[model samples]
Target: MKLFFLNVLAILLRYTNASASFQSRCLAFSPESTIFNSTLTAREYVTKGTNLTFPDNDKSCNQPFQVAAANLCRIALHVPTSNRSSITMELWLPEQWESGRVLAAGNGGIDGCIAYDDLAYGTEHGFATVAANNGHNGTSGKAFLNNPDVIIDYAYRSLHTSILQAKKLASLFYGQKYQKSYYIGCSLGGRQGIGAADRYPDDFDGIVAGSPASDFNHLYAWRASFYPITGKNTSADFINAAKWVVIHDEVLRQCDTLDGVKDGIIEDPSLCHFRPEALLCQSGQNTSQCLSSAQVEILNRIYNSPLYGTDGKLIYPAMQPGNELKASTGLYNGLAWPLSQDWYRYVLLNDSTWDASTFNISTAMLADQINPSNIRTFPTTLAPFASVGGKLITFHGGQDQQITSFQGARFYNNLARGMSVSSASLDEFYRFFRISGMFHCGSGPGAWVFGQAGAASAAGIPFEAENNVLAAIVDWVEKGKAPEGILGTKFVDDTVAKGVSFQRRHCRYPFRNTYVSGDAKEPGNWQCRGV
Candidate 1:
């Protein structure tokens, strides 16, 4: 008994001393450790109870940074490039709450602003989080003018270098190596995460990407051509929100029960072939409930995959059905998308005041030649990433009109073919989830809430356990448990009706959620099986 107690006391003392050393060493990042041959612009040791405040003018999330005074070590790094543009990275270390892991996230849009909300969420969850400004520090594409170096950083280097530094800093601060590293992001941020995995294969063990803008140059070019091709001025002209609701109702009527349930969601949109021509108005029979021939043509164009006529090459993937309303309102509202404009002006044209209306196939062909986003954003080869035991999980909203959910499927299919692996084997490393009735990220008519960073929430579906993307990825990395299906909830919010309406489990790719035999409304009634 005495010997056992002595052994336990020795172990406790060792841990206590190690904890003390970790705190002291973390607080000393400003003075010690190798800089990885980079310059440190600033370092601050935030004590375990400090409140972080944002500028009043910064209305990003409309909430000032306020957390339970966490013990943190913050560091700012600058990596210089040939064109005199520098990559600025911020690393936040959790001193008091060490999760023995590093979580590196990325930015949205062409905006180089660090994602504060994502960083806060990571730190609060006991992760050492880091976010970069994607090379420049502004919300516009003006920074990319005549700056090829900054463009390269934005395309890839910013995340790669920042993650390298973050991991190093984590090891230096904790005096122990992180058990695993993960990347979490959405939209442009999602592209960054995949870019990191492609360029820097060993950076993360697991990654969760949502609505990724993978084909960077073509995506923007496609959006730039939307208004011209649609020949409509606003979403109201193309398909009003009310009209979309009508179309959605019709879609549900036709395909909602194909999954053996009429829950107002087309579970597998791939299985749905809802025809818009059926909604066409007959000659001499004009009605608000039906679309005109022109409207039907435009809808078909919007839903079909775009192909470049110049070389007969595919540009964008086919858009998922049922997102017509949101796409009409948010993405394809006839007006030029600002991000598309930014891509043409800064990255492609080098003219700050270039007219976007003149954007055409010729300009796109030229942009494709100088496509730096190709090697970084859309790496055709991901074997290096998979070789490092890295896992990628991406979720796309079926109702996401902005980027479309079909991009995920196209990318995965290509990835599997490129890697020479079967779909089942590909599922071992990469998995894609298609969320029904979910808009860009979340929030739509169906059970659209899955707890992801910048994701929508449903009532009673808190960001916990397997319901959360980050949590699911963490479990996959730490426990070698790959997620079979993710649970989604429909609840009352400002956008959705009140109360816990239903819970649906969205199965991973290759394995679909099928209704067997039971109460169709209950999640237990469904099982994940091969189609």
Candidate 2:
């Protein structure tokens, strides 16, 4: 009996030791050891927590990844004597992995949560992704002034430091140096991607920036200007949400059929020669349903952006027709407006009492005070970005209502100019695709088709029934076969609600998809018309 008991005790001890060994092995990669080159050190790894969540596939209901959430360990590097500070960050690794590559993403506005979809996509592809809150967290515009640290971080340090620390961590964990590095983001993320390529070309190998906010200062100032018009008792108040619906309906009635089918989707908003004044109730007999004169003027300005000269020459394209009302949600209405107001009042004027109403469009030099889109000042020259051999691909929905697709086009054009290259030459390093009929980011009231899953969302636009932009990025980076054109579809099943049925071709830059002489629904009915 004593010998038998001794044997049992030995087995128990062995089992306990094995379990401890497994736990230690899982935590082999520590963030502190991950250093960028030999000069910088990663701050301590901080585990935010973990959760069990379903994978991207349908079986996610049954089998899920042990999702680990962590705050990137960071070193706060002071920028000279300025109030601004930059952060060097190391994304804490999952407990299971010994080593993984790093993906640095950019944040939008004042809120700095790495986009949930982007993060899921990156981690699933076996990358440890990192991003910064860009200093302050509320809304970017107002937060910049209230906290000196926030503005400085957003200005330059956040991107600079994050890259340095991420590289260091990669070396520490893998023992082998990273074979390749990539960057991916849209909108503000797009801006950051460009900034890195132009400013710190050596940081990444491939970058995918969609709808970049290149001119940060000008864009923010423009948002401030629009907020007063959209908010307050000005003409915008008369138009309001209800009027937006009416305008949307009118735009659909006039241009929805331009694509050769009355499928409720506008194949091209640019081709939509819509005039809101046509909807106005004849002369003076006012109806609550029809727009007032002030309302009509406001709609025109909102849709037409700010006029640069007397001839009504456009400085920037206005939000497309169907997108006027949706800006009230997410960062656009909630964060952007309040923050812009705060910046105009507190940061610029140093007087919180100043009313936005007092500012006049014709006389006031708002651009001088708060400019977010000054390319020259914050220019992203391709030389810096190209030297690193980084690849960047950007996509924006042509029908995007929040920030117009023109913004993407303009940035790409500027990039090409800065690089001293033609569109064809840049195609090797960077690419842009304008998804037709899709809304801001990815969600909208259109039938967007991808893979074999017919129409994915109620607001999804149908073209290529299963072509996902995120998936395209993965294919592009891993395979090296650049996407030439993406397929778009139009839905037909639910008559009341549009469904994906017809396919359209989305041509890359310098190549515009033009309708053939006969059939518009047929894919062969369109050809790439190069500029």
Candidate 3:
């Protein structure tokens, strides 16, 4: 039966000729026969510079091209479920393909669409990139709760189904199975990548998860826990965001030069000790620029320590320096307060009219009963991920304001413990790099934009940080060379004019780049320092 279906699909594909006019459709084939059971249609779209006449011949695979824009094809899949209605998926595939690798990125919020740039880059590299809306689309956090399908999809099913379908589609298009598959994303996408590794270990060979929100239930609870202080307060009145900025500024001010260069980037935020109250506005002055007394206290709580158990042991680490408070909105903030709130109110409580402002943090403990984020409920364990010899590289900006880098560190530690793999042994299968000044999947003022300054200006030269990450992953996968320490480059447009030169170094884990001796502007004078 499968052979018959393949023949039919081949005949159909042969006649189609990969033409621009050919319908970009999704077909549900029988798992055994690969015969079209049903079809989900996709709108014909085009990426910048894509030639429809080329058919499935995507030449961008071997060439370097600047991404001006991306053409996206979105489709919804009704995945079968025993307990819920049906799960819906928002799948994105770049219209052109130059390679066979498929990338699946997870969205941060229930509302925000997929990371378009990430998908564009993947498609440009000849990979089919897929991202899902995680069930429902809404600004409210309570939406997921009322819908059984949404919860199931958000939990794991939707992404898994999407990946399976995407791979099948790729097989049909390329006439060959994907040579290799990879997943790259941050925050929620990070979580999705790890989730894939745990549940469906065979999905991808390489995964780059930046600051994943692994402990979904506990982390959501933590956000609700903070609502008591931050929910009502504006940027001026809120203590959490204000104290975070104060800490961030103080860290940069004191440690900016620690790396032997004061180029405005903090090489390592962990090295800097920050005091929030030190920057408090004088007396009664309260505005967007400064924090008030109440705000400072709240910040202290956020940074000082996590809520502990009866044994006084730590449950979670405090938010690290360099992260912005607002980043939480897109990644952490939206997930915790808005997304989770909407889920709880609408799905579980069936009360769409419930006021979010009235949410009581004191009752947060009850969340476990309503929406359990326990790891046990997850379909897969960390064992299969390591067993299959998969390669996972995760990078998070230390200055991310949303989901904390500490969370990534904590997840790694847990994985290390669960897998019984030594830190060094785990490096063979998984690695995490923390970028000191970057923010949320490589954006924000603190983000290191290597080569951003036209490749000719000293002040705006691109840092080779992100590109190095891409390189390291490729080398690790194809060559079996596990990245020991990644080399980071700092470029200066006018090196001769400034009497300086570009510097490069291998940044190790738990250690940050620091200056050992000599001029601060020079990169060679820096060393990786441990906290």
Candidate 4:
């Protein structure tokens, strides 16, 4: 009885000490101190705390998100990288930070929108979180026009500088040095994550990049190539959303059972030789449920690797077979994707009037030569990052509609060849997981939610190393427990409140989750087998 009482007292004392420490630290936090030529523009200390519903007052950025955090110190900084442009960042310091870790989240697309949701996400996890508006502001990349400095900031400068500044600020606030640092990003954020690993190898100890748009010069080219094929929504070659559903069903019918399960996931897209011709319309067939002959040609171009020039050189990896459902929207919505439009016009050619119709196979080659703001990240060896003992976990959704899922494999294969190390050896430092049925970063027919950035963090999901890729990476960096498979959860109706519907332990690269026995929905029934 006495021992129990004493233990309770000790717990109380510890809690009191932590509370007072946070109080003092919060009070002493100064916004005046700046690093990397950054100006401390705003500071906010929240007492009400946040529950993913905090009202935002910062009007500096046109499309600022309503911050989803509470009980933290928020600091905003603006860094003028060059005479023509600048970068903006927001740093959050939480009271419950016991891990002594720093976190940086990447931005999506070419948007200079600060990852406010990510900042909130990291803060709740007890991390001193920071997110930068990848140079410029708002969701548009038009600012890249006539601003090479802005492009430079977007390409690499913003994230690197924001990280350094955030770390220094956290040290000042806590009066101690951080133990480790991490990065989480998808798409363009994933691109930035790769760039950080390549250029500033010492910045992050662990990086979790999902659907990384890494092969920048070619990625832009790949995205632009689609506009010419699909033309407009009214074009004869165009396919509607309803017919796309029919196509998705056809793809599943052909490929779903390849992994010995009819679970709607194409575990390995490579295993399936997708036949778009199989989806062709028969005479007197329901036109709405089938493709026209020209539409079949469009599907052929999409399913097969994109080719350019008279000699037919492959431009980029083919679109994954299973993403047809998601392919009906976003990048494939029969219009010029703004990011591609802006990149070709502003960043590459510096001609706003440069028609996207003129964009072709040679455009990709031209982009390679110009390489605006030096944003092309592919073909660079990750030797420096690997040498520094940096643990990297990159993932691409198998049903990804934005960027082709094959790029991650291409990157990993090259990494091993360049380093002259077998994949078994590379497993010690870096691993790439291919999440089945996941579209872009998250959400799809399969077990898509794996506790990544943004939505996953705010979804009220448990932050276990098994289900969370970020937690899994931290486990690798801090505890030396390398992940062979990341357990993914498919929430019922994509919401935690609805409860979990199913789960899958998504395998690391060179391996696909093979069915052993029992129910297909059961995660244990699947094993990571070599591809």
Candidate 5:
């Protein structure tokens, strides 16, 4: 009885001491006192802690609310430079359940809010997480107006600075260096991950990029060209929300079964040769379910014509075929996408109030001269990062409405051709996967869960080992066992805890998940076969 009491007392004492140490260290966290030379902006312990809800006060961009975290210390820093804009960073450190790892997440759009949701997601998984506003304070392109320094910071400098300072903070707080570092991002965040590999090769051991917005200048230019051909009043204009559903159905009907399966997802989008003209109204049989001749032409222009540079070089690949429904309502319809519009207005013209209607492909091409985000994220050279034992895995949704999967495909092809390296050689340090029916980052009708943290767990994969993309990357980096394929789960009710409706083992690029004589809906029934 006496020994038991003594052991309990010792455990209590250790817990108390650790708690006390955390509180004391939290108080001593001063950004200016850090090893890095930077002016401290804000230092405070978030007593309420981390939660996913966007705060009411700062609801401008649906910013994630930091409300229920325990022992959370929020540190902000500003590293000034010769330019007008400075590098600003936010580091979120966990007081308890420290994973001894660091995960740096990235931002979206032109918004300057630190990715609070990603930070919270990382902390929940016991990782010390950090994010930046890409060097601005709000979700507005107005910040980029005539500020070259700000643009430079937004391009790649801010994330690099954030990662460096965050690692320093992690070392200081834990009293031991982090064992591994990883990055998770989609869209703009995806672009930033690739940028890190290029500029700061040794920064992270592994990177997870989804739907990367690479080839910045050309992407915007190509996206803008669609407006001239499909604007509301243009001669070739043909898409509307109602008409798009008809086309969406047609695409699936034509190609959804090419993988020897009858599920909704088009497993091999590359093999699906869907023709839009098939849906064109017959003669004068105009109906809401059918597209007119003008509309067919517009769809063809958007999906078949590759944007070319002034020198006749291919600039951007054509948009994919099956995403017409999403494009018609969310991103591109009969007009320009707002992100593409803002790139030309603020980043290029330096005019926030510039009329988007006045913009055209020619003007967008001119804007490339001032492309501040000219970071070669998809460069031919991976020797620097690869030599140091870095691993990178990227995935793109086949139906991504914002940044097309073709963009990723183009980069991979370019890298292979540019370096004269075989695809197998590139797979040593890099792998790209394509999710069949997903949209931009997440959401859609596909088995969209890949165990990526910082978002809702929808993949019904029960095991922790199979569900987290960050964990998978960490295993690859530390254990050196590269992933052949990642399991994807679709929840019955689109949730993680709910029963899995179906699952698919998404094969890495250059391979297709072929159905081989079994239940079509079952993941085990498919084989990852080469194209």
Candidate 6:
């Protein structure tokens, strides 16, 4: 009996040791280790959800996250790019890495915070994931002030160096080089992916960029321009939170049923002419239930007017319909969005006291002139991206209050126009998926959850090429199976436990979701059609 118990004990010990069995190899990684030249400054084997600490001042980067990751090797790096500038990055190497694959995440907004969600999202899929603080340690673009190298890092260098370091580290950690490398991010991170495609084409085999705010310099100008148009909260033309609700209801009343169903979502806002005159106050109507003529004019400009530079050139398109309530709460909350404020204040003027009251076309023209490390991700063509055999998938939400989906479509058109190639040829290397009713990266009345960054990661869905966008891109790169569309899930009340409310197969570029038969919620009832 004693001998039998001894054998059982040995088996139990092995089970307990499995997680830390890689410790020796994990601990072997340090700046001094010479297996490869590395800027890997620190290492830690985290367990029990310990918070990764940063310099105390960097509160933005130190937002407590689940570094409680056991069965993983966490690495910190500092890659010096130029005189007096470096990038802070983190890499998480999972033991059960999926088929020697590497995934790197992109940062959002003017953010220098590591995208821990994307990192978690990647690692959850059995990938070795890496993300950088984008050369600083906060959400403020003030880091760009008096720091041109840092600006350069934010522009494109940080992602390049971080990915290079991560790939090498991942290769060394696993005793083999990665078979494939990929990138995942949305918003600013999306811009970073495109920038990488432009400058560092060989860095990633597959990229999933969502709601990319490319043409960022002009986008900043465009974001700031709204403040002057909307006026201050005290202005007579200003639409308050209540009136914005009225506008959203009116929008739904007019455009919601255009897709052959009434689902409270405007699947395609472009088709809706969006007459603000309809919202004009009826006689004896309560002020809360209608807009004044002055307010009606503001709505017209917000939706119908195009932004132009002083040179009479179209700078950016107007805000598309269906995001009014969200806009009321955020950027249109009586002031310019702080991200835009930070851009104009720190990046352009470099004067902390400067206000955006005078943000006219000339001011925007100056922004275009400076361009700042060429951060504007507006590509004349993606020939270089295509020549290197890269596969790029970009998606923008139809209900996105932040960026107009039109810009995302415009980017696709630019790529084809620049290359003088047909959509079919461009479709070979790059594809754009327009997700109906998804706001920004995720959420809205539509099926918005689909393995995207941030909130979408919460679903914890099993990765499959059909269900997940990340897996779709992977299949595209590895198996040469290009995706026609992705299946988006809208959880009941946006909660996974409540069960799914609906599902839709969001179609790719040059195709629109056309309702044919059966049920509106059933994904198969809809088909991707060229309009």
**Poorest stretch of ten by lDDT in candidate 4:** 48-57
Higher-lDDT candidate of 3 and 6: 6
Judge candidate 4 at residue 296 and give its lDDT.
85
Using TM-score, rank the candidates from best to worst.
6, 4, 5, 1, 2, 3
lDDT of 5 at 142: 75
Per-residue lDDT tens digits for candidate 1, residues 1-531, read: 999999999999997786677667765666224654567766766655566665632353344564533566777776665447777677877655556889988788887877766766677667888888788876778778887788888888788877777887787676788778889888897888788788788989999888888877777777787766665564444666677777777777878888887776777888887688888888777577889777787777776546474787877766677776677676566667788888888877788888777777777777667885563277667888888899888888877778867788888877877788888887777888877778877677666667567423422454565677788888877777888888887775534446667777888876778889888657888888887
Candidate 6 lDDT by residue in tens digits, 1-531: 999999999999986686567776778766336323346666866553556554543676555645434367788776678877788888988767889999999988888988876776677667899999888888888888877888899989889988887788798888898889999999998999999998888999999999998888888888888888889888877888988888899988889888888888777777777998997889898878888888888888889987888788878888888888788877677786788888878888887777877778888888888899999899978787778789999999998988888899888888788889998998898989988888888878888888877445546466888888889899999899998888998888888888888999998878888888888999999889886
TM-score of predicted structure 1:
0.86
Model 3: per-residue Cα lDDT over 67-186, one tens digit each: 423454434344444344343343445545545667666666444343444545555545676655455443344545546665666767767766777788667655578667777666
Candidate 5 stretches with Cα past 4 Å from truth are 1-13, 35-58, 67-71, 81-83, 96-99, 233-237, 283-286, 457-465
**Order of all candidates by lDDT, from best down to worst?**
6, 4, 5, 1, 3, 2
Q: What is the C-alpha lDDT of each candidate?
A: 0.74, 0.56, 0.56, 0.82, 0.76, 0.83
TM-score of model number 5: 0.92
- Candidate 4 residue 451 C-alpha distance from true site, Å: 1.5
Q: What is residue 440's positional error in candidate 5, in angstroms?
A: 0.6
Return whichever of 3 and 4 wins on lDDT.
4
Q: Which candidate leads the pack in TM-score?
A: 6
- Candidate 6 worst ten-residue window by lDDT: 31-40
Clashing pairs for predicted structure model 1, backbone only: 49-69, 50-69
Candidate 5 positional error at 383, Å: 1.3
* lDDT (C-alpha) at residue 24 in model 4: 69
Q: Give me the displacement of residue 35 in model 6, in angstroms.
A: 10
Per-model clash counts, in order, read 2, 45, 31, 1, 8, 1
